[model samples]
Target: MTYLVNDSADFVDESIEGFVAANADLVRRVHGGVVRATRTPPGQVAVVIGGGSGHYPAFAGLVGQGLAHGAAMGNIFASPSAQQIYSVARAAASDAGVLLSFGNYAGDVLNFGIAEERLKADGIPCRCFAVTDDVCSGPADKAGERRGIAGDLTVFRAAALAAAEGKSLDAVHDFASHANDRTRSFGVAFSGCTLPGASEPLFTVPESRMGVGMGIHGEQGIEEVDMPRADDLADMLVDRLLGERPNDNQRAASPRVGVMLNGLGSVKYEELFVLYRRVSQRLEQAGLTVVQPEVGELVTSFEMAGVSLTLFWLDDALEAAWTAPATTPAYRRGGVPLEGEPRDADDFAAIHEQAAPPSSEASRSDAAGVLAVIEAIQARIEAEADDLGKLDAISGDGDHGIGMTTGTRAALAAARRAVEKGCGAGTVLTRAGDAWANEAGGTSGALWGLGLRCVGTAIGDSDSVAAAAVVQGIRDATDAIMRLGGADIGDKTMLDAMQPFANALAEQVEAGTCLREAWRHAAKHSEQAAAATAALKPRKGRAKNHSEKSVGHADPGAVSFAMIVASTATTLESIHEDVT
Candidate 1:
């Protein structure tokens, strides 16, 4: 049974309670679920925002100095009731009046509309602005039907500045609407997410695949496709966004662009950077100058592994507001540039040029063992691609299954060629790592390649790997992974399995066990250790938000590594028996 808190009914209030408790200096809970910034000066145009509870920083966290003046918090994945919106509006209003900003959704529209009536009846001047920037959410022919994604940030910034400048409600509303019209967003999700206090996720996605146009609430997407490399995925998202460029044929000659790389909760900052590099490269290649690009977790779904790309066609007015100094917990500007061109071309070229070449002195027997291990791992990954993808959907980018399968297949082919050419085991492993790194091109590729090289280095010139050699090799590989990724044991990573396996092998080797027997013991211990990771809260990696939920799921990397080791040990044993 899935472990989850069944507190959905109280999720909204409880979350707000925590939010207010932590941000008491910046904001105060007024009436209903409305939170208003204590720093909002009177007589300024008040900007009020509202949405569901899960998308923090959207409708609630944005309420602070230089941000939203007030926010109406809603239930998890549900729109706030009209009464809540009305309460927020009344609390935030001044002589200049209040401007309501929110994402475009049916429930939000219905509820906010009712609130608008109540606010007007109470003699509060109010206007509404809805953000509908997701190009993938709606058909091109009916752009109005698109849902809002990350573009809400741009809309809120414009409205808040207009209000801060003491403009009337009408002026702030107009500016917000204009920002919404100019902005466009597209997103892809590898997995789905569970609402607070829910036993199951709201939806499910297949393994080795991604759902384009997925909504923040686990809504179905336009289509699912085989998971591609970061560059390929970035290209697809950027191309779609560029295709929807507002027909400025008659309006402006050179349109500056503002890009926001939004993480959907589960993706790590490092992985996001990998994706951002591709995005900036694509934008530069398209001849569109990015005035300023925002990266990080500005918008998110609760631990959902996805990313959204937002492009705002900037004018002088909007650019001024965007570039204006602002401070918040999650969003910031003017510290260090998060995205930029490569600083050193020479360093970049050196790193890229370190590809491994085919080996020169591998024997047939050694080659066979390596090939067997590669084939077994590849076959397993292909077979479980869907399952891995599904599991990842719950807490990470769902492409683990597909990414591993594709990479293993490529690595296997490289290994086979190296073996056929009589290369040594080390050379074969090096070539395989290089092939996987170049062809697969993602977090997993770099990791798997590093592991292969580690193993190859430990094996050195051994005709047959002994239990001690294998354990040392795995230790070396683990060290490489930790060095490259900065992930340690209990981080819900493959190291959970690897550490235990290495220890078990070392113990068995010390006890005078045969290589095959030691492997059996290690694989068994590794499986238990992998399963044990389900109880660990993720301290690192992309699934940091849902660290709690990731407790019960085995680390995908660990499981795969165990399988490869077990297969190799068994194959080597069989070869020994044949020789005897």
Candidate 2:
């Protein structure tokens, strides 16, 4: 449990501040994350790695002379926003190119992919390679569907080495992709990691049981089994990893591989030592030549009592890269010549500011109503937070409720502030969206942010809001969500409820129905759609790995969407009556 924090809300930000202070010589602070303190050689490929904040050395500690050029840190257990990633990338970008690497999680994919797009559009050469290495997350045929875990370090190290070799962007990307393909990992957890401020753990394992195939984010495991001895545990890790060796590596009679026995968090070096001993003996017996073996915490999950084993089946290039000289705050090998004094924390290479869009008094009048609707949703989400979190924990990390509540509360506050400032409807929503995205920090947060921003775009400030405009706004929000999140209506996400709501709203508005009546009708579709998602399987995100476990539960995102829209319909009806 994370018991030593001052405030749960302040933990991540405060920790980041302390990290930069402690590693002043190795890294400097950018708005989103940290970059190397020393200047990158001109035309060097800046390898940027990142994800959520809790994992220590795997991300920020890897940013130095030889590993990642920078890292885009997000909230604890949440992926960074696109803005955050873009900011870090801009800080780290050089004339050569930018290579963005992160684990293959839904929020990380959306945020990092968005950053890549923006970087390219800005005329900076950039590419992203998401690491997929956890063998338990998917079958060999669907390897890309696996979540990246401890094996992320191997992929990042190999990519950074290729970049250090001054390889072209294409070459670096290919190197990282190959490293990801050849790598495999499996983990077991004795206990769930408790997030900051939470009294109880996310989930619990029986006192004598262990969770097998667990994720880094406190996600549900594939199965539970009686706890075994250290040697037995080592065997479990090695056998599972060895069973899924890359198809290309089958040709080698004795394949050379990189091995990592990683402690997830609270597990000490003494315990890890016990596990790694047998791991080494068994691999050699299985005709595998273990190259440089790492037996310590490489990636962690916020004090989780767990460990994961990673194997990177190495080719010639991978072996050379794996043994390359590197220097970082947490992990280091060989020597790097000192250039000069490290850069100041306040020093920045590039910074960009976005201005608010224009709004008129007419739309500003409508914003008051928007604020009321948002407040209604916020209250509803607050009421159902525990239930939503429980549902999400069945397959996901159980943060959906917390993330949604944080986002809605932030949105509500922002909307209220905008109303006080006499902002237009579009401006109110735009500010609210930005606040939610910034505060919540997750896949759902990003999608909701996009949805609100697109809605604001369609409902411009100059014009008085009309039925057609409202319908257009709803359609635009739906389209933006689909474009950004890559989820179809049947994917058991917010889109499951959103699409039905949009269709019903548009159809009713077109039929000359009153706005309140139309919204009520549309809300019913959303509620029904949300309920129907219980029978469907999750096709994307972290939940996909434990899809079977969530069979009889409604999607948290879908449920939240339905509940919010239903409440909003009631608010609209109240507003209509008041206006009448």
Candidate 3:
């Protein structure tokens, strides 16, 4: 993989140097890998934070006027050396002394523990708190051992505020520790990520499957499960969080929750917001008052396809600290402060607009044959999902199988319901398209949805989809796919299969061949076209990275497209024979 660095060993230093250079006015690099903001308030208790690199904004990014007094930096995914941690502790001390805050990881604990002992020996007065917020990382009985994820932000913010408020060093430590206790996080990854200049990813999940409880460093998760819709994923995460509902049975008190929808890295903002909408809805349903929900890359791995959820049980002290105005390079609350606003009113409507509307047409069975064919296609994909994912993994993000399976399953379910309702092929396809859009939720989803919608438009009310109509449908679907995905035939995508199928169907129609014969011809052409994609280097889409490795492997998207066309062809041939 291409990397933006001079050397893997120097990656951390280069990045921190650049960071300090950019924010030199607000931050100054100290002796022990610590970046201290020059404008720390006088005589205040100092707040020090540290963590591994790559998860930016956690340790260094939080250093500013109202946040950390100083931050210690570690190498990517590796804990800072003990000497580095001690240096940061020495630099961040005030008359009230310093409080060291960092995530709960083995390396971090060992290094930071050494730093704490060294500092105490020198009579500098230092204490330490660890953020153990990731619920997925450890069992309930051992939650204290769980690695901290995005919850580091909440812990740091609380500690910073306590220090800024003239609290004693011990008090600041207590507040930060309290914040850590209240926070919990869980994460899922669709794909693994590579370290800078590394040729291989740290770990990988099969296509159409998610790694539940995945850590930030590409660690194998607790389980692998079939990927679900955005709403379902959000629900699962929220349920796990709410299931451990903090005991608030004391004295008539309402529970307040603070949510952070954090992107691991390289996940588009649009996809993140889709998840945020669902997360907010689930939290509301759980009867928790969500205050000032945060969404974005608060903490991130290096371009990993994953997201983590952090929920903090809010209290007066923590809530006050959370709402306190703070500025950092990655996190800032510059807008109207979230405090004093009616807590019940969540402004998520703008974000929730991405969920497409359902089909207006009622379901029906006039398209039973078409529905059967779609189901067959769906079954084929489900059966071959693992194989396809393996193929795609050679050159792509290994999601083609999952994307195809997800889109087809949704399409089949909708089509089956339409058939039961006696709907025509057009209505079935249109409804299936709508369902695909609502369930799949990605660039591939939009493409498949458009393709189905266009095909539906071409086959409107036809008792049998004729060869000419099938040709037109393929043309329409191809056009829509192109418009949505901007991929062409040689891009090693489904377009390779689709374009050939459409052209062959048109030729058969011109020659006045039987629908069965035309379909057979189209399916044959589609299979060949799909195989041909193996020879064509990918110029776009996720497969661009392994274009050479992909040369001998059929494009998963193309292979699936051919399979669908073949299934449809076979089903239509049976129906034609019955009619004759």
Q: Summarize candidate 3's per-residue lDDT along 1-580 as a digit string, tens digits.
A: 3279799767877888888888765566764454455434456777888877788866788877667877877656655645566666666666677788888764566456556765787887788888888887778778776788888899998988888778888888888888887888899999888888789886777999999998887654688999989999999999998876556442125578788999988777899899989999888776778888888888888888899898988888888877878766566765322211221212111221223233322212336666777777788888888988788778655656766777788888888777766666677787787566434434455556667777777767645555566568878878756654567878888889988888888888778787777888889999999989878988765356457888878888788788877877767743432122
Over 4 Å off, model 2: 95-97, 120-123, 249-254, 338-369, 390-397, 416-424, 460-470, 511-517, 541-553, 570-580
**Reference-based lDDT, each prediction:** 0.72, 0.84, 0.73
In order of listing, the candidates' clash counts read: 6, 0, 8
**Model 1 clash pairs?**
191-393, 207-389, 362-423, 362-424, 534-551, 534-552
Instruction: Write the number of the candidate with greater TM-score, choosing between 1 and 3.
Output: 3
Highest-scoring model, TM-score = 2
Candidate 1 TM-score, C-alpha based:
0.56
Q: Candidate 3: where are CA atoms >4 Å away?
A: 249-253, 334-580
Full-model lDDT, candidate 3: 0.73
Q: Best to worst by TM-score, what's the order? A: 2, 3, 1
The Cα error of candidate 3 at residue 151, in Å, is 0.8
lDDT of 1: 0.72
User: In candidate 1, where is summed lDDT lowest over 10 consecutive residues?
Assistant: 336-345
TM-score each candidate.
0.56, 0.88, 0.57
Write the number of the candidate with greater TM-score, choosing between 2 and 3: 2
Candidate 1 structure quality by residue, lDDT tens digits, 47-119: 8887777776676777765667778866565556555676677766766778887887745654565567557
